[model samples]
Target chain A: MSKISRRRFMQISGSLVAAGAIPGAGLLTKSSFAAEPIKLGLLHSLTGTIAIAEAALVEAEKMAIDEINAAGGVLGRMIDPVVADGASDWPTFAEKTKQLLQRDKVAAIVGCYTSASRKAVLPVLKQSKGLLYYPTYYEGQEEDKHVIYTSQEATQSVISAIEWMAKQQGKTFFLVGSDYIYPRTCNKIAKPTVARLGGKVVGEEYAPLGHTEFSSIINKIKAAKPDWIYSTVVGGSNVAFYKQLKAAGLDGGKQKLLSTVVSENEIDGIGKENAVGYYACMGYFQSIKSPENEKFVKAIKAKYGQDRVVGDPMECAYNSVYLWKMAVEKAKSFDVDKVTAASSGIEFSAPEGKVTVHKTNHHVSKKVRIGRARADGQFDIVHESGVIEPNPFPKL
Target chain B: MTFRRGNQAPRRKAVIPAAISIEETFVTFGIFVMQLFNGLSLFTILLLMALGLAIVFGLMGVINMAHGEIMAMGAYTTYLTASFIEHHLPGLMGVYLFIAILLAFAVTFAFGYVLERGFIRWFYHRPLDTLLATWGLSLILQQTYRSVFGAQEVSVPLTTWLSGAWEPTETIQLPLNRIFIVALTILVTLGVWYILHKTRWGLRARAVTQNRAMSSAVGIDTNRVDALIFALGSGLAGIAGSVFTMVGSTNPGTGQLYIVDSFIVVVFGGVASLLGTAASSFLIAQMQTALEYLMSGSMAKVAILLLVITVLYFRPNGLFASKVRA
Candidate 1:
């Protein structure tokens, strides 16, 4: 009983014409609405002390997501990355993880560079039932249902490297590390392993974190005359330790230094002259020769730039993204429970080599490589192990 | 797995014998000498850092929380100088360090002078306010350094002359950098001593410290003295930063690491007393190095802090309290 106004009639006719122009408009609209992108969280410290190591991981993760999206994404849904900065603070990590899981409703998260930050966010992720893909060689003795460790544990990293060094270098070992949970735990594992390998631990010393003066420790090393120096020193201290070591005539060639933490990224800070001959053991090295690695290294360098060097952490982070996608595709759903269950035994042809998630612990079994640093800031792979099982709680 | 089982039984026995042999006198003597040198090197750096803090906190009665950041400014200056020299005049790289030190001092001096005139002058009488203000200033400076230099730690390349160690004995090898730092500390200390005791500006500064009203009445221009003294203190901190680059890496947060230790040295040395600062630095450094040699680093720090508290409890005024009229 009402007359349609001229503007109202125009609006109604315009919509009607647009709708009629497309066939099956109602069904088409519903299908397009259902094709929303899957949200995934990327939490990393973009600022603060740890950012030096973490920024590269973020870039690598982005690269993996891009690669997956290019290949039509997982289960026909594109990944929508929600990046958050942890700021190198532990509590901030927990807060960001909660926001990512509850607010953003991300299906999965791939982040946390330090053990402290990981431990801080573990409870939150468990409460939310969100999955986290942690990518770093950690001092092990930790396992959680909500997390998957993509890197080597203490057994695969510290124990394996020590045993190899003792066999190759000599029976006398000197242990030095920065005073913190990771280094302390690493030394705790190394101490017993050194004894079991029929080696003598000549000296064990720890400097406060950020402690630069290593003359005393270097002096003790000289006096002890240890055949091999097993170092777990991290951060800025590494530059001072290595430079002072070289200055004090304790070059790797003379003392045979081996570290569990130093990689290609660290060599940039320590300088080629200081780090060149030293040995580092990790799951991945840039110089690793494999079809998978070649493709990965090329893709990362091509995308990020040629000057960007891929380190152990970066490789593991990139692999974690792909592993998550594989698990999601296998599970056939974005539900956290399904993805977590399917995650077990999910194998990815990681840049390092073939890496498979252990059925029970959610830790990946990976090949550990011992690489001698070259003058060009790249590692020369000296020894590569077969697929070593992830032993989070080593009997030692 | 095979080695794990076979090694379990003998591990305990092997550790016990090794632990006993570590107590051998020859090894102990070598360790003692090494720790002493280590302690001396630590003391040298602490003294350089604390000397400036002593002047500012002791004489000015203004709690300068940004003392460490001023030192960081010096370090960054040195870094820039080295980078410039490395790129432009590679042939003069060996002699660049001396020039870098001077530039560090000048840059920090100008910075401190401007800071005092613009911000610090108003909060001189309010210790708590000055503390908060300077703390804020410290953070601002730290962030500024982070933005300008990027957060990653950078190290100055050691000149050819300072690259190696001088080994006097098979058991002892002294790093040339440490020796240089020690020598630099002594020279700076002597220079500071001469300025505070022998110079006209030093007399005016001391007078102002004792009686501000009387000094102003006598035409001393107490304001000028305060600004210059603050600038000098900051310049000394810059020198400390310059020397630190030879031993450690420089970053935005590097200054924060040493600020607490510098304050400890200053307070334990009786605040304004230069001699007290030197003595306390030596004592604390020795205690830390010796304790660290015996126990864990954290435990050593805790033990030394406890010892300092106990010592301070008995002598509330510090190690060498100067007699001054209220």
Candidate 2:
């Protein structure tokens, strides 16, 4: 038997031996590798600014979990999903992650919306030796042994977006972003890439995170007359920025905006009327028209109801749980070490074509899709960077 | 006489040509037109946010830091209503905004009433304690909202009339939402004015605000007026929040950003006088908006705060304080 199977057998057999003193002692087996339900923990920001995005992830995860459970569960045993709310607080994410890892003793935990929240929970997950499936388009410096990044890496998402903008629009790029580590790092990567790609960084400005006014920034953009705006601004601020941009008469056909973070979900706040015609770069758009994507979309709609909106992060999160299931089944054990070891180079058919887990850095190979906001709060996929390789650790 | 005045204007204009310079003319004209509209719009949102806070703080003197949370509740109400309209009543999304905004006011008003009765009523006189208590309450409300709503932003859909730019000009394209907010503020202010100046409840409320013992002796149920005022204020805040959904995102922690500004407006407006509140709101909004044009938003905020402090330092009771208070 393998070392993991041996450890599992010992652990199971030890627990069974302890339970052998109970009424079911007769049915108790000596083997530790006996059929056991795998318990996975789900932590999410259920009640804060991130909650709107985070709730969809939880729903997607549940849908995936249900599908896996319906298919006789992973490794012939049922899957138990233990959910905990992060409450949108950074410290709460860490606290809840600890509860999931220590108290619940889940096999693997899938959670986190923001980089800050993910960072807060990283040490807890590491110390407890828990596997984490982080689904976010984050600044890709972090390469944790325990994390399996199911979303697009920051460099791939942002770089591909800039390249696409340069080719489609002219080569003048203006960087606009919310003043946060993610946006700052994203802008940092974008500025150099713009220079390398023979483009000019006209005017780079930072708005306070959750800032609403964009008149000044918009005026600066109009004055600078950049070909396309490269925006990394996130959250509630986007609503104000997009509205103000439209209000200030610099919208759609007049001036093209290429945002790294704005997605179908953001369109809800920005209103379709204001957001229509703005280009946003993300891995997943709602309008992907593949048979696999259709089925995935159909399934999600059916599970969450037709009125529910799906975004890139939600799709990645849905894929993450199923990907974990595939990894667990391939390894044929609940042991984190064995599961992780088997996960590397593992391929799973996702909504975004075939996604393969890069063993070295743990990020999945993803397609880069640039979509424009439609009139009805949905995205129209304008460009797709087919099967881009996951480069989690860049030579920078 | 008209021709003489016009002809004299040319001779006088030549004598003091510096006063009629193109740049100075534009500047003055810009300030005059923009500041008037700016004052009106600022008063609209300010009144919406402060009307409820004024009652809560003005009557009970309970420094409710969670008033912003109440506004968030209203914004979420509008979001949910928009969702409902999109789902079940697609044709009524425009009309739904009105219903949703009104519903937000009612719901938050009820919520504020319950909150006042449950916990806030006990700590009426303890301003510092109430401040801490309400701050804690605000945190709890924010967390509860996050737990319920999730972390992602849920946008409230606006009708074509309430979305996008209003003006044809590229230089001065005011958003339709801002227009709607301005209109809503006027209607709300009028409603508040009617309640405070014209109604029997207003008399009792004002009497209680002036001196609680005197109002009670005059057979006015001060307690009832306090509760009603609190609800009215919360409802106004709800309307403000609902209107804000046109321009802002609805989130659990979104309230944190506005509460400080709401308090500043109410305090700077003078605690008791509604007219004082209106004046201060205009001053602050105009200062912030105009200064934002001159400097960065963060720097402008600091400048406005400094201006408020300087003004308040000279006139301790605020710019339009009551003669008795001064």
Candidate 3:
């Protein structure tokens, strides 16, 4: 080492301090910002109609953050989360995304439940050069560079479900969903897939969101007498749909109805007895028989309370945090571009088993599952499609 | 809640079956009959929901924004009752609903009494103030319910007797729960009518609304009458909430979904005419059921709401506006 005067050493240290290499605190936040907490934004509807589902998602994400901080955090820095309320409004999602990106300047955002909210946030994410780890299984029509979809896309979920139904069940499907962009788009793809698989889509209907009446649709379904009914009804309306379906004598044992939306959380709301005999497809289930999943469920319940149950999106929301942490570690920096680059082809040991970030599409490759809802408010895993690749724009 | 993959193609992992058996029959006639039945089903439920709002708004002249919350209280009460029965009276599972209904009424009745005494009574005669104040009360009640019974919806298990459908023919199936709701709606509607028209309490309620100071001078105990009428209205709403659990949800904001529709029903039926309320709900329900059968759910809803607006424009006093002294 070369000998240096005390005055010269002080000057170098002063310049380093001024440059913020050592942060504002003397020796606390050091290692070129490694010691400082990396701020991550968590956006979800904490209030309003969507809050019943989205609020729990926020809890799942926070649980991940708490777990990450408890263990050694990514890049040797504690993760600090900036929570934003989307308030179940699309414009609010855009506003919050802008605030999270431009104001708080979070390294990455993990949020949004509805596809509308995701679409609202997309433009803002791209413009701000921010990353969003969206956890919802949505109608995929884009491969955005600024978004990393942590859940399955249409091909990984809806197509796989329709294929299974066509093969094992009947050839006819009555496609139904809550009238929204996601449901309409899903049905659009589903109709083609059913045709491609040499199955007939007997009838298709879109009930308005929050619609509680389904008797007329059930009447149509009965008239159509399709082998399977593919439903995409979401939110509080699900309770009415399931209850009415059961009351109409079309139950799990007879009428083969499978929903892409209802999960353990929803089944809990729809009542186990009401959902019994129906089917749901997802990337994860609380009953997934895996040591990793068992641990995840146990740990989540231990923290969130045993009364609380985990669902596919909740698991994916939890996975988004870990996936982002892995990306940050792989890049060895929190730079947006670097994280995006390192995120490609990243593999995570999620509760849903091994989930991989697609090399190019920015979506994940995960297992697709179809489970029959049992009376115990849990799914009985009936079928599993081996890890399926994500395609944001599937050629029809 | 639902997702799809974007552009690109991949072979499905499953092997395609060479042939699939699909039934080609669609029972169009049976569907027509079912659509009419669905309208009746909707009418019964809507009437049950609107009955309480009609009474409260017609007699009190108070626009209660928290009416939904009061109903949610009933739903939560029913849920609590079901849980209790499941744990303690497992054998009574089949009839827990009846017990739950009575308990929901009593609980919400007490709650309504206190609410009117502490909160609503102060805002009497100031309709707009009641609207704003009750709106805040509704929010507070929602948060309170959220704290008490987590934010998640609490579902009440339907009894076996109420779970099945009565199928006269393979295609013509009527839900047992809806039938049950219909029977209950008729009984409650009649009971409410009897009380309002044939009872002394109803006369006092009517007198106070007609002339509060005059009724007070005539020794009606106008304040007590106001509290009782409001409590009775709340109890009815509670019953509506209990009935709603069979077909709808039970959450903190469960009240919100029905609030707008409830107001629409009351307004479209003249302000103080119960018969008008019943008639309007019937018309609205039948229209929705028919439109839904003929078109998309969204379009049906738009058409129904548009009809209500158009009618309101033509008859600002609603379909059965009274010619009584103003």
Better of 2 and 3 by TM-score: 3
Q: What is the lDDT of residue A153 in candidate 1?
A: 90
Each candidate's chain B TM-score?
Answer: 0.91, 0.86, 0.91
Each model's fraction of native contacts: 0.42, 0.54, 0.72
Q: Give the docking tier of candidate 1.
A: acceptable
Interface RMSD (Å), each candidate? 2.3, 3.8, 1.3
Candidate 1 residue lDDT tens string, A1-396: 889999999999999998886778776776775667899999998777787678779889999999999998889889989999998899999999999999999999999989999999999998999999999999989999899999999888888888888778568999999988888888889989988989999998888887776766776787788988889999888888998898777876676888999988778767667777899999999998889999999998898778767889999999999999999999998899999999999999888889999999989998898999887888888888888999888776
lDDT of 3 by residue, A126-175 (tens): 89999999998888997889999998887778999999998885699999
If both were scored by DockQ, which would come out higher, candidate 1 or candidate 2? 1
Please state the error at residue B5 of candidate 2 in Å: 46
DockQ of each: 0.38, 0.34, 0.53
Best by lDDT: 3
User: Which pairs of residues collide in model 1?
Assistant: none
Q: Which regions of candidate 3 fall more than 4 Å away from where they truly are?
A: A1-34, A102-104, B1-32, B169-171
Residue-wise C-alpha lDDT for candidate 2, range B1-326, written one tens digit per residue? 68879878878867788766776565455444444454456556666778777667755666888899998899888888888889999988768988998899889989888887888878877788888998999889887776676665666666766656665433345557677887877778888889899998887777788888877998988777877878888888888888887666677777876888888887887777778788888787767666665665567778988988988898877776764321
Candidate 2, RMSD to the unseen true structure: 9.0
Clashes of 1: 0
